[model samples]
Target chain A: MAHFTKATSVHDWLDQRLAIDTLRRVLAKEYWIPKNINFLWAMGMVLAFTFGILLVSGIFLLMYYQPNVNLAFDSVNYTIMREVEFGWLWRHVHAVAASVVFLIIYIHMLTGIYYGSYKKGREMIWISGMLLFVAFSAEAFSGYMLPWGQMSYWAGMVITNLFSLGSLEFNGLVEWIRGDYVPGQAFLDRFFMLHVLLIPLAILALIGLHFGALRIPHVNNQDGEEIDFEEEAAKYKAGRKRESKVIAFANDFLSKDMFVVSIFLLFFFYLVFWHYGFAMDPINFDPADGLKTPPHIYPEWYFLWSYEILRPFPKDPGLIAFGFAQVIFFLLPFLDKSPNAVPASRRGIFFWWFWALVIDMIVLTAMGKLPPQGIYSTIGLVAAVAFIGLWIALPFITKMEKKV
Target chain B: MKELKILAIVVFFTLVTYWLVEPFAHSQMHKHVESEGFTYKDLPALTKKGDAARGQELVMGAGACVGCHSIEAAGMPAAMDPVTNSASYGVNPPDLSNVGALYDAKFLAALIKNPAHALKVEHKFTPESGKMHPMPGFYGAGGDIDQEVADMVAYLQSIAPKVDEITPAQAFETACGRCHAVRYEKWTQIGEKPSFKKKRDELVFETKLEDYKANLTNYMGKLPPDLSMYIRSRGEHYLSTFMENPQNLLPGTAMPRVGVNAEGAEKVIEYLEDAGDPKRAERDSVGVKVMIYLLVFAAAAYLWKKEIWKDLH
Candidate 1:
């Protein structure tokens, strides 16, 4: 087998600035993505596609969207309703699609968690993914206030009011994000700037870092039910030249990827035509009105499970500190004690994992549907115990099962 | 034996999935409050099994119901109908001949009093952003004879429809059609704006017509549900009383207490009281569904036949 070649710029040989063909060839040949990857593996592609869509569309939107309350809303309405032939439709679709994409990301994250995609060498990939998720949420919040509508203004007011509570200690950035003491037109303008400008660029950087870390070792599906590829590759190292020849990425997986793409388009178009879309309000047409809060003030559905968790916290709403609780939860990969992922042979561990996730989800969404109350504390405590059980008990169960 | 084992497992799982999903699907109606829920009896129906032959003549004649509702099952909208090309795109007014196949009386009731409301307002769940017929806003602030709305409702309910209605049949075939033509004519005219009562000079027509229009419209200030099958879709006959004097129905209802003179109100009531027809087609070949299914199945069969038949030869 060829020894690892030094990173080469082929400018001298090709007399060209970039060697696109060589890069393509290397990727199409040597990339060692897991051959046994299932649907969860697809989520990376989905996230990549979503990020691209957000970037391209967001740039065009920023060009026309006015974030100052003076013209922010009406300008959006003008751009969408009257100026661009189908601009209104696109604007609404993008806003609503952001909600959907994040929900999808949340599901993708859960799939990773449950399948133990974060164990061992996969830790960087998981941590990078979590960072991307956090950045994505930050992007969503900043983007939401750009429209500066009654809904956006009130939601901003509710979120930013907590910034000054002595400990979380964002003395300026929170105010900077708001642009004023309270959410209004100034806040809206600067938010639009950050949402369209700052966060998107940072998101791109984080995505690169994520993929960079992911490629270091790929995911640690160490004990999943599938064949382990790195192990399989080690066995064939002596024969890898021939083996790689036999199973070039294009030949082995490209056709399968194409088939999956075909099935995806079939269902996607079926829903696009049949259901058209799940319609929602276009918020930018109306300026922010602080006096009123929409009766149904749930966060985007991606956060429903977390919102459910927050609902059950026994402390008073103000005392229970937002974002901190979640940042702690994000450190779950480190907290996990198992040396590697739970093996499929340890069915009891996964079963418990599945139930904990499912119950937490149900209880959280149920909490979202209700007014926050004290009784929910009991429910949250129960859910927390279950979460702790999976985090601690399941690892032990897996270890004992292996020993047995 | 191995294949049989796989098939058995597939069947077992299919049964489980169906059970889990069924309660969430069409059963949502039963899950909601029964007082204002959908029922089969809330649809259009004919009491007496009259000859479809006689029913055809009335439909074709002064009832001129076909003037608005075009049921292609009978024939495509007459190419030469008076209101041809009236809409920017032709309004293929909801077909009623086999509407029994399409919807129940409650839906029909909502559609009749207000056709625009039925399409755009009630079924707002559809993502068809534009391309809606504005027909429901026909009620005038004054001078609309609500009797015409009642008669139209009665006659529509009177058809020998697949869907059975709780209303009576004689009114549609006989009395309901007399003034109903004017109603559909009014609906046809209120094209883009989609309101009936907004027509100029609506007040000069009558006094009680004014009051009845006023009260009902006020209570339903925001886009109200369609009114075609008001009796059934409303889940009450109380709406008619509101038409007589709407204040009785809901305290703040702006609906006028008009056009329900004792005779007209009784006649309208008598018309809305029959329920029985069972010959509706539940499934037929729609162009989209049939074309896709045909394409998929035919391709599969042809491929299989080619592969296996060559070997057989």
Candidate 2:
């Protein structure tokens, strides 16, 4: 039997019914964050902020955006841009946010890897974050089709065609996904729904799951030091805050997060206003025409690294390597084979492995954008092979670490 | 020190990525066509000045300019209706109200003497192709042909609006609108509204459109693409160079050099940008304010963070 508080005012009445105070304590006030964490930890919050911007801007755009293939191009280029007041601002912000969100995700994921944040107890956090990444990728791909421009049509065509499964001949599945022989009215309509509704709901749920998974293990630190959260939190509550290794997440950690977030917004809006061209491919200015194809077709920059992996090989092998790159990141925790959970710098040969992977990814991304002719083709092939080789070498290299 | 090192690494990687993805890749993809000798030159008629009054008489009389073109700003109307002109010439002869403001003086003189040579479309309009240029060259049509060419250019320069006063939309109308339609601007090659009300008028509009497209295909070997999105598809540099000499980038292209001077080209580019990316100015201005607000918020947040962490350290 629980004793209920006397309902004096609205707050007291709500508190008694909802356990609002306890909920806040559990979720925010008493949630412990390691004090040794750096600004990199704030990327999660930045991603959330970007998603909020996307949702608001997307809703406003949806007011004028026609999902019909014929009208989508004009609605975006003319009605939204020329007729509606500040429609361009919403568009620029949405485009910049879509691209920048991927940058932050990559940083967040890399930070987690750098500090071994996925080790043992925090696997759910990583898995949930990866799920969010996939959700975001899907959301972006679907949103890209809403414009019905050349790149939008062709990219949709190429990506859907990938469903054929090489020699297995699963082209029927491709038609099923597109709802037609080619990307047309049916393709645009379904993608519009996925972009605006389905994927966004999934992303929101995954975000909640990701944050919820973080509560148990708290968060990894810059130094990867494992502090006793219960003891440090107790010490802080008892007024020995200076001696504690953890801090209350409500105000103290939030202030730090806000600081990083503000700085990020400063950079983000700069891109939105002045440097938005990168977000919008110039080739996409042309309206979709099925009869003509662009000379060179490529995915957005965020997907270029994996796209390069797929491009350098024959159809079957390329598909296999592409699949490998996509699934390999999720298997990092299992493949690492090291007992120690510390920063790469302290893990000996893992440092070399980490930098090599990072540089190799950069190379692959650069190669993806280039025309695969002569030297570029050779470079792309080597990088793809090296990427696969590095993952195979991860277990062997990390296993040799003497539990530092 | 550690933070500085990390920042340096991030910046270095960002630069490398940007360089490789944008500038370096662009260079490899679209090799720059040299602009040497592309400008129309060697028209000595332009060097010698003439009387605007005499020029106006030659233009109205011997030049037969009003037979096709309408210098609307100068109160000179076309002899034929726009629809009839499209049927006769395969495209509407553009209103030359802004020709003096848009084209180079030498190019104008050359255009009067030889339309194919001035437009750099001689390759397509060759005798072997059996396609005659609609506008016959006035090279030896009458007495004092050089003086006639010079006088006509002078008269055009006299009646035209000042270069600065002409809007980008007007420049595009005179320069490219005869062949290319910007559907987003509700502009068509015939400069006529697509009728949606009366059945007869709608039929007339449809026939005119079909005739214009068919004639354009027969004349140029293909119908020209709409200019609504060309500014985006082909970037500014590519468009500028391509306009300077179409054959340099796309060999054997039917597109003729319109002989627009540098200032005129700028206006045309501005119009394209307006159509393709209308939000650029708003985005840039609002971006500044947002950045300022963010800077202030970041400063305050940083101070609050410093204050909160002070006791912990």
Q: In model 1, which runs have C-alpha deviations exceeding 4 angstroms?
A: A1-16, A74-78, A81-83, A166-176, A220-251, A265-287, A314-325, A342-347, A371-404, B1-313
What value does the lDDT take at residue A45 in candidate 1? 61
Residue-wise C-alpha lDDT for candidate 1, range A291-311, written one tens digit per residue: 656544545445545555544
Given candidate 1, what's the lDDT at residue B122?
Answer: 38
Q: Taking the tens digit of each residue's C-alpha lDDT, what string does model 2 give over A1-404? A: 67886899998898988989998998788999988877788888888899999999999999999999879998998888888999888888899899999888888898888889999699989999999989999999999888999999999999999899788889899999999999999999999999988999999899989998998887998888889999999999998989999898878899989998998888888888777778898888889889889888988888999999999999999999999999999999899999989999999999888889888988998899899999999999999999999999999998888987
lDDT of 1 at A318: 24
Over the stretch B1-313, how does candidate 2's per-residue lDDT look in tens digits?
Answer: 7766876776687778777777787788777875533355544435667678988877777457776788888788787866678678877788888898899888888888888888888888878979888887775436677777788888999999999999998988889887888887777777735648789887888788777878877777888988877776787888888877787798888899878888888899998888777667776677788888888999999999999989787
Question: Each candidate: what lDDT?
Answer: 0.48, 0.86
User: In the order shown, what is each candidate's alpha-carbon RMSD?
Assistant: 14.2, 2.2
